[model samples]
Target: MDKFKKIDVEQLNIVDENGTVRLKLFNNQNIPPAIIDGEDILPGHRQSDPIAGMMFYNTEGDETGGLIYGSKKDEDGNYTTSGSLTFDQYKQDQVVQMEHNEENGKKNYGFSIYDRPNTNLREDIIKDKEIRDSKKSENEKIQELNKLWEGNVRRAFMGKNGDGDVIVQLSDSKGEPRIRMVVDQYDTPRMEFLDGEGNVLYKLPPEE
Candidate 1:
């Protein structure tokens, strides 16, 4: 085995015996595009900003999930930082994730579990892009996109919000929060149950 005191590299790939890329480590400029079912789909899905991170691939080379983090200070001296570690659900999107996001001096961090449809996420993304590029009006596009992405639901989240409250929220299938337990910034603890329409039905302590 060869050893080096230090190695400088922008990107690296770890492959299996059959030469399939099982994992990839990369810099912002070297990050690979999203790969699904052996096809490279939306290249611009990550948006215009550059992020450095690593990607995880399954046995068939499909991207399952990965960890990514980036921080930047703008010309106006404002700071933005974000990081996430996620695990995908088969051919779908993230089923579980831990994330942190901060901008200026505000911060939010949480762990979440999502419920996604069995449909192919790659296909949905491509169709969404097509709809956005078509001649449809904004309302029509929004309606179609809403129907298309309705199956993606966040089922649970436990995190500290930007307001400094620590919260554990659970939602229904339609992504409506049904229960919330929180510790406010002032150290007040409260638990509430809500109806489907988000009206608080009950609280731990009876109000005056």
Candidate 2:
């Protein structure tokens, strides 16, 4: 045993015996990219990167998830910040996450789970994102994806919403909020049952 000493470091990476970066801690100026399957999918873009966080890698060097935080105030006097710890599905987007965010004077905190798709569905998602970002109307493309999204990656979340209300939301495969429960800042508890189209069909207290 030896006497402990203080250590100062802006970034640190813990690697496996094979030299795979299984864990990394970095500052905003040196944010690291996501590594997947021993390859970097999205890397830091120099000063443009706003994240100050640690990334976690899988045994194969793929990006399983990360914890990140960034905050800044623009010249216009608006403050923005967000922090999240996320877990990714194999070969897909985030499947679980704990997040807290604030923007435009609103704040949200919660945990969520996202269903993942198979290989074929993953390709569809990639294509759709590209189309959504193109200089074209996304209506048709959104509808197209909607048609294919049935029974795909659904989502559910429980959190305290921006208005300081506790909320639980469950979405259908089409990404429609089908069920919801809320406890507002005033401690009023309410529940809503919705149809497939997200139209509320009933309320726990029954509407007047």
Candidate 3:
């Protein structure tokens, strides 16, 4: 075996004994699409999608989750960068995630957790991705995707915001944040209850 102090490569793939792709590392110029359970995710790309990242596969070659990062600068000096670490629930959706993002000087960092129904999230995502790719009006696409999320996965979000505020939020089956508790930058704490349409119904410790 040859030993080297360091290795530089354009791309790398780690496969399992059964020749299944367990992990992959690649340069930003050549990024691969998402694959789960040996099934490829629909649509090769999204609007300014991440350019580089590493993906992980489960025992059955299903994509459990990944960590990805991307950045871009345009001629007009506008720029955006983002990174995310995620973990998918078995047979469901991404139940945990940590993410950081910056765009045109605006920066944010947060993490979240979700609860999904029994449906296979991998399939649901693929189907939704394909449906999203259909050549329909932008408004139509949004409406269609919303249909898929109603009463599906999505449950809660608990994290800190860019403003240094920590929050715990609960959602309804339709993926609406119905409740939220927050500790602000100055450590001021408050809680809110909202209706399904996002109208605030009440607040704990009424405002001064």
Candidate 4:
């Protein structure tokens, strides 16, 4: 079930003209015009499909928006809300799925938004090595690891001045890996890595 499940056209300003409906806007307010499928809503995307679904344009047409889907009960006690979006797994966009339950006049909305990139550790290894070798300019590499393995393990890295540093990695209950480097002051210039639990995982070899 996706999040865009429940909607009401009247609640969202979806108007009926002849047979086709269009979203109306206020003069001063700036928001994406919503798409209506009967009473269902489809929010516009921030990037692609700019003018296809719903048009929230100014005099010049600078569109910034996202999709919104919904569901609601009718006077006859029937519920309806619907819309859909296609996604490429590699595109790095998020998917939101939703489900709703209504009984005795009380409604419950449940949803999940998948926001993580699929794992290909082997491909990531080369990228990780590049980060390790590059002069430690930004914390992005470390942060990437943290985000990549979040909730699965504790990880850290340690290294030193010249060479011969061993990388240590550990996994938590979920078997996600985080790295640690162990190197001495005499090794090729590098910093020490420590895990969230403050455990030292790797130590670099002594400089020759």
Candidate lDDT (C-alpha), each: 0.92, 0.79, 0.78, 0.38
Candidate 1 wrongly placed segments (more than 4 Å): 129-144
lDDT (Cα, tens digit) per residue for candidate 4, span 5-87: 77544234344444333443322123343222222133343323212233322222222223334345669877654332222
Which of the numbered candidates is closest to the native, going by highest lDDT?
1
| Model 4: lDDT of residue 125 | 44
TM-score of each: 0.91, 0.80, 0.77, 0.19
**2 in model 2: Cα distance from truth in Å?**
9.2
The top-ranked prediction according to TM-score is 1
Span of 10 residues, lowest total lDDT, candidate 4: 153-162
Ranked by TM-score from best down, the candidates are 1, 2, 3, 4
In model 4, the Cα lDDT at residue 194 comes to 43
Against the correct fold, how does model 4 do in TM-score?
A: 0.19
lDDT score for residue 74 of model 2: 84
Q: Candidate 3 — which residues are off by over 4 angstroms? A: 46-50, 121-148, 160-166, 185-188
Error of 3 at 117 (Å): 2.9
Q: Per-residue error at 128 for model 1, in Å?
A: 3.0
Model 1 residue 17 CA deviation in Å = 1.3
> Whole-model lDDT, candidate 1?
0.92
